[model samples]
Target chain A: MSSTNNQDFLPRSQKWLQISGWLLPFLYVLIVAALYGAFLYAPRERVMGEVQRIFYFHLGSAWNCFLAFFAVALAGVLYLVTRNEFWDHVAAASAEIGIVFATIVLATGSIWARPIWNTWWPWGDPRVTTMLVLWLIYVAYLILRSSLPDGEKKFKLCAVFGIIGFLDVPIVWMSIRWWRTIHPVVIASSGGGLAPKMVHALMIAVPAFTVLYLTALLLRTAMHLHQGVARELNQAVLERGRP
Target chain B: MRSLKLIWILAEKDLRLEYRSRQAFLTTFFFALLILVVFQFAFDPGSTALREAAPGVLWTALLFPGVIQLNRSFQLEKEEGTLHGILLSPVERSLLFSGKFLANWVFLVAIDLLIVVAFVIFFNFSFEAKLAWILLLILLASAGFSAVGTLFAAMVSGIRTREVLLPILLFPIIVPTILAAVNGTQEVLLRHQPQFLVRWIQLLSAFDIIFLAVAFIVFDYVLDE
Candidate 1:
């Protein structure tokens, strides 16, 4: 495990660790500031009241969720072009974090919807349904990754899926939007313009969540790289021990 | 022109194999029939509620059995080791995707017609001129379904959990197809809404083009060993 070849892996892994080490304290402060911005800084909604506070985090997570999935597709394209395993790690890590943010988006959206929309799950809302479908697609991507053994085949196949999944998103949203508009359900419109103060809170919360997503993506990707190196070392040890 | 012939030859090869055995064909049709029967029993058959829900039932029957066919499309190739032989040949990867997709689309459309007939009978949809619209919906929707399905089936062919994994990987991405298909069927059969049906058909056609192109481009990676 400690061979000279293994030594080459160390610095790369440590570089990521060192970067995250510096970023972690900043992430902590940013998150605290974000929570403050959400709970106390943003003005309470006149209509939805205190529960509407969830919007800041929800909107932030929603923004980053789409961004994360875009990263997955971008990484997939890079991996295909370069055949570099690093992009696969980026794809995988982005997908995992994307699912987390999507879950937050759905959960927060659902919680907010209960009082405002008068339903926990609004099937009539295109954006809501689109997010749900997006969540399911990436969840399937992760499942496909788990089912396959680790190799070029796994990376290549996952990259293909990531690209296809992202491409499907816009069409899914459009179709659902059309479906909902035709049916014309009676849900309240969520579209009124936001106040300037509320926008300021969102600006803070969005960057805070964005930073958090980056930190998680970096850490998870570094861990995947470490796992790859460990597997190679383990294989070498087993082969040397045999016969 | 020669490329088209090559693609047709590849598709014809799979079609000929299936035509010879007819195993997947019979089983897939029977499975689709069973789904319709199961739905009939689950719902109050011949009731107003059942009429309302028939479009959902029809598409569900159509969608689920198609997965079986998709899985088998590559499973047969993998089992016979023909995939390796095909890969060894100097065929373009995109052409290979089109050929496999064409075979799957043809198989799906054929079986989907039978399932639609069975659906009409079980759900009490009349044999009318509007049924032609249903047929068109089947053609467009199956094109999109098979495009994505062929790519994914090739992807999961080597994995152990492919049977379960294929649908999990497939259904979400194909939600637009399902929504459009079911709603289009409803517009034709229940509502008599030609204008709305046109919109649904447009969605299906758009989905078909987008996914077919995507699957064609990305298929090179799925088969890269």
Candidate 2:
């Protein structure tokens, strides 16, 4: 009976469940298409050979990292303004995804650099350093959330950090960029920029990753909604029974 | 006027506690001095490598130990349950933040000055008038550091394992200040012409102001009951 009441209360979650069920298979197919475009179709670099292929997915994950953090920041602001638990759900989910995708960006870059730069990690790379700092910041943000006692206070503090941590993205980029240019360049390679086929691959990879992120967001938020329903039930019980 | 009195009262209380026990102050000072001594041994004395790396070394010594001071700011409050009594007062939260921030900044700067003297002596850096510039940088950097640090310290003060958690949370948020301070020190100490010194100082000052204002406004949330 309560499960039926939960379904009635969460009609929108049911709609999202249907939408995700329809979308998940399509997203996987897109991911496969992106893989094929990146690996099977795109031309390999003459200078770096096959290792250059990591750029496709590396850049793809980088895009999603920025997108996810921006979503976290936006959701945080919305949560503060609306006092809505759903926005907290969205912010926390996006922040966690941001960390994962950012780690992918850094890891793939490290692997790519090993063969090209003759090192597993190029400490001097501004982009790489910025990504590491961003990774650290988000890691700390996640830890902050988990360590806080479970309550409205936890959500509020996390939201405040979400807002403050967003301030670092620009600073990280600028400081790293400045640091890179200030020192003499070691990898004086030409900018191939992007070939048309490579661009096409990135296009597919970006949306594929984006859709995957959205799917994760949907599922995580749905789970949060379920927990939220329990909280609401407790609150309602207090309201009805107390006074 | 009442707020000013309260801010002073809060800072004075912290200062007196430190003066009596010198727990955070003495330890923070020794921790920074120990870092200099450790690094001093790691490199050859008066080696060119040491000269080149001095600025970065100096900041690592200062900032890491400064974290000790930051953590102590609230840990003391939590220990005595004074934070609860303080928060229950009619005083504004931001004003309370100002008091804590002021106390931390002053202590950090004082500890930093002694470290700088130690740094110069250990590295065999020539004493000169330009040392004043390094002092200014420390002042601005410590202001920015303690502003955010006090806020974060109060935040993590309630949690378990906060002694470890404080630096993890504090460092990333204050990266720009660290970068600016370290770079500014590099220009001041290492370079002859020192063109970028002004730019780093500008960044440091800008971050100090922006973070001070933002932390003040945002602190009310962290202090939420």
Candidate 3:
């Protein structure tokens, strides 16, 4: 009678997954081309020289990371309110993706910083430290979920943590302001923001990263659904044999 | 109204149990004291360096004992299955949270007092800033921590890697409180700037309110088996 079971959910979404998976590579190619045009064909940075080229992917990755975590916090709230396994599954997937992209954001920032600051690492920088903390919070979150031996308890505990652990996000973001306020090294803001050329590069790259994010989230959630179905089926078969 | 009574009951129970056995309380106190002594030796007595680092050193002293006490807070309940029993009771689950919060807050207060007294003797810092405000900051910070701690403590009770995971989960979120408390206490110590203490106080106070409110509203979900 229940058409909403995990097994049934998979067959319907299978086609969408297949389509996105195939087109993802092409999308990446188009994004890289647009990015190339923005950075090279557009115009050159008058001040920072070639080093400013990292802006496209940097802001793009950072945006995706922020959205990934924002999704986790939103999913967390939904999970707490509804107490559903699907929400928890979606949350876990989003957290893993967030962690991956956050790492990339840090990596690209380091590469950018090296040329700009002459240093690969900058401690006490608010965004960097906050992102690192965000990484750790979700890392422990994943660990907490995995340790529960794959049962209802695992889902419930993770949902609770997903909701609570996000309290660190804003604090992490504003820590620089609250503590030191020296990070970010703002080049400009608003109408005076990144040069037209750099802005054009970001427009291409941000959507590129977003497309990648959606594709990753969908694929990961589908995989989790598949494994969960397999587990339930195995449990059903085991119970029948026992009887 | 009833919740406050329940909280006091739980706090008194923990205090009575501690008074009899004395293991948990003394372990925490000794652990904190040893760190203070270590800090004394680690830095030169007459050096201006130690004075500069006093906030960090004092915070470190409080943090070590805080973790130790928090780790032990749930041990008795877990062993006897009292936590589950408590959840199954007719009392509201949020009351259960309040009960734990109060008990742990008391433990922390006792520890804080001992540390502060020892801090004055060992570190040679003056406490003339404003005793009432300083105490208020400590209470607010402790309450925030105990609220979050109780929730995490319950979550970690059934897990295998709780001992290590608890700190990993709790510390990053509470960093603001520690910073505010440490810096606020430093302001109290030096008497250089009084206005900045208000900001730190506001920060810690805001954190305390947020954690308390969240913990109360969401704690029922945590008690679900």
Candidate 3, residues A41-98: lDDT per residue as tens digits? 6576776677767766777778888888778878878876766666766888899998
Across residues A43-81, which tens digit of lDDT does each residue of candidate 2 receive?
A: 987888998888888988998998988888888778777
lDDT of 1 by residue, A109-169 (tens): 8988888888999998988899999999999999999999888899899999999999999
Q: By DockQ, rank the candidates, best first.
A: 1, 2, 3
Write down the TM-score of every candidate: 0.96, 0.91, 0.91
lDDT of 2 by residue, B43-141 (tens): 987799988889999999998898888888888788888888989988899999999998998889989999999999988888999999999999999
| Residue B118 local lDDT, model 2 | 92
Clash pairs, model 2 backbone: none
Residue B107 displacement in candidate 3 (angstroms): 1.0
- In model 3, the Cα lDDT at residue B208 comes to 78
The DockQ score of candidate 1 comes to 0.89
* Cα shift from native, residue B203, model 2 (Å): 1.8
Specify the highest-lDDT model's number. Answer: 1
Question: Residue A177 deviation, candidate 3, in Å?
Answer: 1.1
Whole-model lDDT per candidate: 0.90, 0.84, 0.75
Instruction: Give the per-residue lDDT of model 1 (tens digit) for B1-225.
Output: 977988999999999999999999999899989988988888775889888899998899889889999999999888888989888898898898899999999999999988888887777767888789989999999999999999999999999999999999999999999999999988888888789999999999999999998888888888864
DockQ of each: 0.89, 0.63, 0.55
Pairs with steric clashes in candidate 3: none
Q: Write the per-residue lDDT of candidate 3 for residues B1-225, one digit (tens) a residue.
A: 777888778778777888899888888889888988898898899588888777678778877678767767787887877877776777788877777778888889888888877877887766664656667777877887887887788778777788887887788777778877877776777644777778777887777788888888877776555
